[model samples]
Target chain A: MASNWEEFYSSHPQPANLSKNEDLLRDFTARHLNGDTRVVLVTSGGTTVPLEHNTVRFVDNFSAGTRGSASTEYFLDHGYAVVFMHRVKSLQPFSRHFTGQKFLNMLDLIETKDGTSVTVTSENIPKIADVLRKYKSALANGKLLELSFTTVYEYLWLLRSACQILAPLKEKCILYLAAAVSDFYIPPNEMSVHKIASTKPQTISLQLVPKILAPLVSLWVPNAFVVSFKLETNKDLLIDKAREALNKYKHKLVIANMLQNYRQKVTLVTQQSSYVIELTTEQSRIGEEIEMYIVKNIVDKHEEFIADRSGRS
Target chain B: MASNWEEFYSSHPQPANLSKNEDLLRDFTARHLNGDTRVVLVTSGGTTVPLEHNTVRFVDNFSAGTRGSASTEYFLDHGYAVVFMHRVKSLQPFSRHFTGQKFLNMLDLIETKDGTSVTVTSENIPKIADVLRKYKSALANGKLLELSFTTVYEYLWLLRSACQILAPLKEKCILYLAAAVSDFYIPPNEMSVHKIASTKPQTISLQLVPKILAPLVSLWVPNAFVVSFKLETNKDLLIDKAREALNKYKHKLVIANMLQNYRQKVTLVTQQSSYVIELTTEQSRIGEEIEMYIVKNIVDKHEEFIADRSGRS
Candidate 1:
């Protein structure tokens, strides 16, 4: 509805933090290019579209980054170096375990005549210890790099930079695009500089956000195994739309999900065949995530892809 | 632009959590009605408007609830019962100090041959101890009641219920409505049940959210000391808009602040005159907040109003 992706880059100013994050991405990619362990860039959470220049209000998506955050941990468990790019304030890999108010329940405050102190309750120590150990292990091994963005502009800019950095690894890299990106945005030229006063009925015009996956697949990180997602409210449209994305973008696979029961099941749509990785009733009830199976499937396929590329070469 | 506030309520279904939260409000207010101390209902954070029926997206405001959360602690310090109704996931009292990634840095993980354990490192214990003590004291005394809402519809419904429950307190109650409420929203008929397709340019019509303060001040809790807020990106409109709101709503005070330096300063506007409360350069450098002085001023005004009424009777 407005400009092409390149024009969008030229017109909009680069995010102030882009250069700093780019440096981090470059360093992270450099370290992970050991050829022994494959690296994956997993994008999580949702990008916002600010309606105003001085943004007091913006459009947001309802992803808590559960799929991405949970998936990052599973990917790490499989010994993959993960560059976890997420929306600011959304869930992260390890911290996601205890971010809610229930975190307060874990700590016991002690009072004494001398002063005060805080200790993890005897009952709660095991869970905290487990998460903390894994988090520290990830940091010590330098296997995880975390980056965050809030707006669509920042996300796109950072995504491009990350892709360029990871492209050197060729088929050894995997690009997992899971962030719930905005489909529409108010163009920079049309956005309000001040708060839109609420004096009367207002009409807002939104332009179609340029499809970044097209360029992301073909131009950026072309050799990487690209897996995109399609989430729909209507069950009938889910697989068809996912297949459409796979055909159009020419990516490795499409993960199709319905908004109603995304956690319980996800369909993997590929060029040759499409199949589902579903959680059994017991597995779901006992707190088993579908991500464990999804990651296993992807790791297996990625192995085949790398071997196939080597065989062809 | 749409129907009146009453009509809006009748048309929209009540939030599922309303009755549960109402019980909390009733119990909290009943316990605080001992004639020993006053109570304040402090609404914080920002209300959202869902864009679709099955909401993958919504409109959100940019308030981390720094003001409301900080003020809740100060109000608790002053021995006033506090009802902290806020937007879900926004910052809250005590916990706001350490919700970020730095929370991880506070603990040291010890891995030994026996097993693994975690502890609060010596350096970090002091700060966490202080916050934990205060948080426990408030909870133990039953002085703070926390409630949360996401949508504007839920916010309005909850506000009315809280007001009805607090009306019995008369002049002893204060309603500090500081939440960054949305000014406009889409009607039910206009919103898409599924995600809005982004193949073309789209037009979204937003109707003005009816001014609930009109009914709130005149009918909801007429005897309570009510305070509202006006935040402006433009400096020139700040004071004028605050005064306009006071004249229209006939509330006790309006806190006016420029978006740029809201943390550093704010103007307290009443019918008689306006005065500024600002943090000194020394205070600002050491991370002193302006809410301390603002809450002090409001407490003074509330005390005087209570005394005046007592004398008249």
Candidate 2:
């Protein structure tokens, strides 16, 4: 069946049905082109494990894709072509379709189940409804939503494919590995099962599946400017671990975050220096911090490093 | 001027213009309460920091109050009166309102947004939309959303006020600190004006402010069930750091998360045992795991601990 499935897809040669918001990539690349288009891949949300045919176990996270989507938006605002590989239900609109009257319609249904009722309305209701309508209008117009992905394997597969697409654009491409890919997956054989019955095995144990995505930095994505992330909770040892990951992965930069508080805590670790990022509070107005900061720091460094290596800026 | 402002609000209490949604809080409380309503305080969303008179900086979080609201739902589902202290833009609903047409309306919206626009004559959309509508609807209700504060100082101030409200209910009350707070804040006197003229700071220097909310666990919320979160990024040193924080703050449990991969990686570090959480790619189905695994783990433990300590079931 697997062989047949592969052959069918191979023979069909279908366009990958990718969806997600990658305005950051487009914007980032447009502003600072390294003689090529910069490609960014952002993975998000969590995957599920099938416990049974009817009942499945969800491998999930607390991330609503705020960080990933926010970062993705920043990238787009700056001119980079982004390939956002994400799981389902991320708060981010996979395409502009995630907004509009439909969303508010959900709200309306919640208030008054029957469409004819039209019971719930107030000073704020219209305002809220307007916001929803605007969102839906945006989605209808395809202005907000972009990019897509559904599963862990699917995310990985498309991400690898995106890397391949960006390979030819290497001199100008940048790979920002920000998605939190799952560290494990169900053994392929159990994909169709309904549930892992206790009677089957009192202690069902499995082996760790080596992460195939991380190695991509050193292996396939070597030509592109790569930035990896290392999150540590220890305020004392976060930088050290970040440096270690940078050294091991040989990526240009490592974003280190102290797990103490996540409102806005990201530290950029490079070969020579570590810059702590104090993200603007929720109260602050939106500006180009993530994009501006990275461009000022990483992209410029990439240019300088390349110039020093190849004797051109 | 500050004192005058305080006096104004004190003499003329800010009229609670309770919206229809706010009214739902009462319904939820009544429907959910099991025994004597001892004490309940629920914190939601990101806080806002007042800058100028009308233009205040919002130093909030990326949290949409999904977790907070879900927990609230669980409490209400189990019959508990709750005092919800939330931030702006919370996405949870106060109650579950589902009807025939209302359910179809939700489906139409989902389909319209997805662009499939395929009509589902079946009750699938209503059933699903009814289930998914809680987060946003609950938030629309008149929950206590604390505004003001750019730095952690202001957040701490608002938190203190909330604590004061919950003080009388402290004996059997539970204080759920689910809001994502900024650990750092700008000094009130050090507030600066935004300048688009210069792209750089003339003399960029700032001093660290003391954490205002930390004292609440030991001081104001002494007997309250305090559950604090410690977000970290390192895998190797997670428990050690979490344990250290637990010792310092002496809270009940520290919900620790790795910095960048927080959405996917979580760890529950108690005084004795530690449980590491890894999210799989299961799409929206993962909410169940969040409740069953992480939420249940803590609640069950807390219940057991409380029962053992108080010698009650």
CA-only RMSD, every prediction: 1.7, 16.7
Docking class of predicted structure 2: incorrect
- Each model's fraction of native contacts: 0.71, 0.00
- Identify the leading candidate in terms of DockQ: 1
DockQ score of candidate 1? 0.72
Residue A197 in candidate 1, Cα distance off native in Å:
0.9
Q: Candidate 1 has which clashing residue pairs, if any?
A: none
DockQ of 2: 0.02
Candidate 1 predicts chain B with a TM-score of 0.96
Model 1, span B2-86: residue lDDT tens:
2499888987899998999999988888898876878999999988898899888889888989999999988887888899999
lDDT of 2 by residue, A107-193 (tens): 333334453222222333443444344445544433332455544556655665666555555545666666555444444554444
List the global CA lDDT of all models.
0.88, 0.49
Candidate 1 residue spans exceeding 4 A from truth: A1-3, A112-116, B1-3, B112-115
Residue B264 lDDT (model 2): 60
Chain A (candidate 1) TM-score to true chain A? 0.96
